[model samples]
Target: MKNIYTLFICLFLASFTNAQDKFLTKNGTITFFSKSPMENIEAENNQVLSIVATKTGQMAISILMKSFMFEKALMQEHFNENYVESDTYPKATFKGRILSFDKITATESATKVKGELTIHGKTKEIVIEAQAKRTDDAIVMSGSFFIDLADFGIEIPSVVKNNIAKKIEVSFNFDHKPYKK
Candidate 1:
């Protein structure tokens, strides 16, 4: 009986070690664009972390608010300090599932991704169109979505309201590899 129990435990652990059904990445990229008449703001961060369950079509992504880099140092500072309140909210995250997981293959496929995005301590449901290419070695997923600053509890100063757009465009590229034990 003890041997049978040990066998059951070993099988359970071995099942989790299989990497083919899961994919993960540590250095995905996320970019945000805010275009206004006064100025066009653009920032990119390559330190995103993401994971995907191929069988379940479930995915999650995390990005550090402070990691986003802007062309101007002042813009970066203002983004973190005033806009996003990076001190209070250090990270932004998204948790959702890919709609057409089975359709993902070595060829690129278009699909809709639905998930909840959290930023600046607020969360909102979002659906966006995405392109995905799955190869034997990796899965690449890319998408763009628009968000309203007010929806995420982010406020722009009235003095520079024209410098920022009320709706920001956010895009991401994630290349995930099979998880290994």
Candidate 2:
């Protein structure tokens, strides 16, 4: 029927338009490093989920705390059970908007992204400087930032006080392809 054909056409167009307005990636990378007088520690997680809304320059990211792998198995175990308490706080999240986002092109540009970062059940407002690029098919973002452990109520025990740094350096990268349903 003519009505059925029109309805199908409308649905197709809607999806097509939506694909252009949003980008997503399931395997983004997030790494963190801590330096102390005793030693340096690092961990990486590749199972990060991120989304970008091209229309509003808004972005959201979700990272599983347990997904982070450390160089040593004991360190990883301590991180989940002693430090981050992964059982109680399983995920870290970020929701933010990109400033001067419309200026990004196929060429990488320095952009400011402001957002709320939630970790260990605590939230903090943060502004990060990131390199961002946008093309017809994809959006790429990479950046490094520092976070204070005390801000999130993650207390370091005195037994290993010299083993961890107060501030941790975090790096992230996400290449998002156009989202399609």
Candidate 3:
């Protein structure tokens, strides 16, 4: 009877030690900027949920399409209905890993996180130089990267072709908390 009890305790502790480290945030923000000769356009979504599973070196992020807001309502509507077609494709996701997880140290510094980003129903590999810092109880990650609209099948009308830059800059600011299983 004592042997069985000891085995149970050992198994429990082993499972706990092997559990993955997770962090979650719903108030994260993802913003984009597009520069054109005619005008500059910017949009942002604050309801982004991101999770980092450290043990597996896996990270995932999801953002609601309708959460993206623009300065003009018409632009916002068009972005969802015409451009993104949010009704059909409601979220954008990325499921990848930090290529060099072993090289990362628990300190305030910048690291390159390479992963695959899925946007508009298409997946593309991207490398982003992200700044990371370990706070009191959370890990804060921020970075800015560029993406070409055409790469994701986002069509640009000829009338406004010159106004928007080919490459759009995307920025992310996330505060993640440890996820306990």
lDDT of 2 by residue, 12-115 (tens): 33543576688888789999999999989999999888878888788888788999999999999999999999999988889889888889999999999999
Candidate 1 ranges beyond 4 A from true positions? 1-18
* CA lDDT, every model vs. true structure: 0.85, 0.88, 0.76
Give candidate 2 regions above 4 Å deviation. 1-17
Cα error, candidate 3, residue 79 (Å): 0.9
Residue-wise C-alpha lDDT for candidate 3, range 49-93, written one tens digit per residue: 776656655667777788898999988987898777888877787
Residue 68, model 2: lDDT of: 98
Candidate 3 TM-score versus the reference: 0.83
In model 1, state the lDDT of residue 113.
84
Candidate with the greatest lDDT versus the true structure: 2
Q: Cα lDDT for residue 78, model 1?
A: 96
Residue 136 displacement (Å), model 1: 2.2
Q: What does each candidate score in C-alpha RMSD?
A: 7.8, 7.8, 9.2
TM-score of each: 0.89, 0.90, 0.83
By summed lDDT, the worst window of 10 consecutive residues in model 3 runs over: 4-13
lDDT digits (tens) for residues 19-46 of candidate 1? 6777878789999999999989999998
